[model samples]
Target: MLELNFIRANKSRVIQGLKIKNFSEEDLQIVEEILSLDDTRKEVQTELDSLLAERNQLSKTIGDLMKAGKRAEAESQRERVGQLKEQAAKLEDSLKDTKVQLEELLLKVPNIPHESVPPGATPEDNEVYKAWASPLPELSSDALPHWELAQKYNIFDLELGVKLTGSGFPVYRGKGAKLERALISFFLDEATRAGFEEVIPPLMVNEDTARATGQLPDKEGQMYYVERDNLYLIPTAEVPVTNIYRDVILDAADFPVKMTAYTPCFRREAGSYGAHVRGLNRVHQFDKVEIVVLQHPDKSYETLQEMLAHVSGLLDKLELPYRILRLCGGDMSFTSALTFDFEVFSAAQKRWLEVSSVSNFETYQSNRMKLRFRDGKATRLAHTLNGSALALARVVAALLENNQTPEGIVIPKVLRDYTGFELLN
Candidate 1:
């Protein structure tokens, strides 16, 4: 959430930013409505304060009158105080309602794009930030997609997954299962070596945790809810991992805090279907290793770059052809001030599949989470960032499709030690 004062003082800039994000007229109206509601709340609070002050003064006057033996006058004064108390209560209720309305309106607003963000309304407008310099591999005409290759090698079972759970949840077997485990271990090891402490966060979080991370009141439908317990199945490790510092106030010495976690993310992927969702292209459950950081506000962008390089290094090791995109205003997440998506080229599929996204929330999340840092006597919001070191399913798809041979699917050299084999056959 944006600082209410910032939004109020910069309405024009906020509107322009929202326009670049392709917000509809109805959505833009909420922006103005929030300001109006905030004004009303201020007015009500002022009146309540005045009433409270008057009541306090009246109480003193009533005591004085009683001591003077002016019983009738004191009794009349008591009636006036009672009236003021009722009015103050009503105004307090109004203030509470207005705050709720204002918060709901603000929640609908996406984070204002950074000045460097391009003005665009879709992924097509996102600029390519970097690209692999090496030539992409050419595959033979007989090259099969990951799904077909999975069947040939007995590495994964989709029908078995359907029988066990449902579509959009594939069961990995033999080499495929081993490859998945190897990738997770490799990612965690890489993150730890880079000074990130590894953690095992809970898979389910409460409503407050979801809301603190900006996942609730917006993306609720995209998550699996445990209604009886009022818990949400985490969509990404970022939620729980970043929330680790929620409501914390750190000293200046804690300028940079980094943590990584491997988790099986669960998502509803509601309204998704068709060919693009086939095989490992899209799934309801997938394993991923995520890196989250909390940094002093001034150092956040630097930290973001470091995270980007870390993910890029992983891709370089895997030898997957990939590109990074600076997300346009419309393509960025609601909580991110800036985001970069990394896409790995799947040669056989002839498409770029996103394997990672690194973002700097720049206090957008910290404000909601109440995460702050103290510098001597002053305190301010900290900046939060997180990235998928790599999401396994799609990365696996790219590997199987791009490196397939007439004999078998060759594992990336970096992963050979982890998998304990050169090929998956």
Candidate 2:
């Protein structure tokens, strides 16, 4: 959400920024109209308040004049008070309507972009910030995809899972289960080493948490809801972990607050279909290690880059072939001014799977959370950033798909110490 005053002051510049995000000029014109309503609201409120004050003073004067038996003066004051009451009441309604109009418009405006965000139109517009040295792996013509490989190795039971629950719930078995555990531990360990405090938060969160993280109003369709509890399953760790500081006032000393959590994120993934949803690409429940930071507004972009570095380190350690993409305006999420996606090459699946999204939301989430700190007599919302340290299923699929050699599927060296097995065979 944008401040009304800022919108009023920077209407043209803000509109240009919105254009870069692919927002229509007509939608921006509507915002400008809303700004006009805001001005009207403030003006009416000022007038109504002044009238009320005058009416109160007149009432007091009328009382004193009546006590002194000055009938003429008391009568004149009483008449003015009656007219003033009618005027104030009418203006009050006008003020209320103007405020309502302003609020509705304010909520409609999206977050502004950071200076570092590249101006572009679609996913193709995103710049590649980094790519690992590892080359894409080659497999034989009979090479089974990750889904087939899962069955060949007896690692994943998708049919059994769907029978027990539904599609997108695949059960891991034996070493596959252990491999999942190893991935979780490895991600958590790496995040910890990068100065992130570990947290174990509830899977379900209240509506406020959802709203604060910019998930409620627009993402209700995308989340799993527990009606009896009136809570929604978190789409990402970013929802619960970031809400930790909701309505909080922190000290400046807590700057660059880094935290990580391992969670089974549940997404409804409604309407997803075709080749993209095939195999390990889309699932109802997935594990991810998320990294979040609350930093000084001026340093949030820097912190976002730091988070990107941490994710890059994990990918390099895992030796997964991957690329970084900067999401253009059309692809950016509602609350984010900018976002970068990390896609790992799934060799067996023969595609790039989105493994992580690192974003700098700036004050977007913090302002909604009411998360602020006092810095040199200035109190303002802290900037927020988050990224996936690693999303397990996709990376696991990538590892299985890419590391498959004629001998067996070779495990990456970094994970060998943890999984206790070099190959799935």
Q: Number of the top candidate by TM-score?
A: 1
Q: For residues 241-350, write the lDDT of model 1, one tens digit per residue.
A: 99999999999798799999999999999888888777899998999999999999889999999999999999999999999999999889988889999999999888
Question: In terms of lDDT, which candidate is strongest?
Answer: 1
lDDT of each: 0.92, 0.86
User: What ranges in model 1 sit over 4 Å off?
Assistant: 24-27, 56-78
Task: For candidate 2, write residues 264-348 as lDDT tens digits.
Answer: 9999998886777876789999899999999988888788888888898999899888999887776788789778899998876
Model 2, global lDDT: 0.86
Name every residue pair that clashes in candidate 1.
Answer: none
As for model 1, its CA RMSD to the true structure in angstroms is 2.3
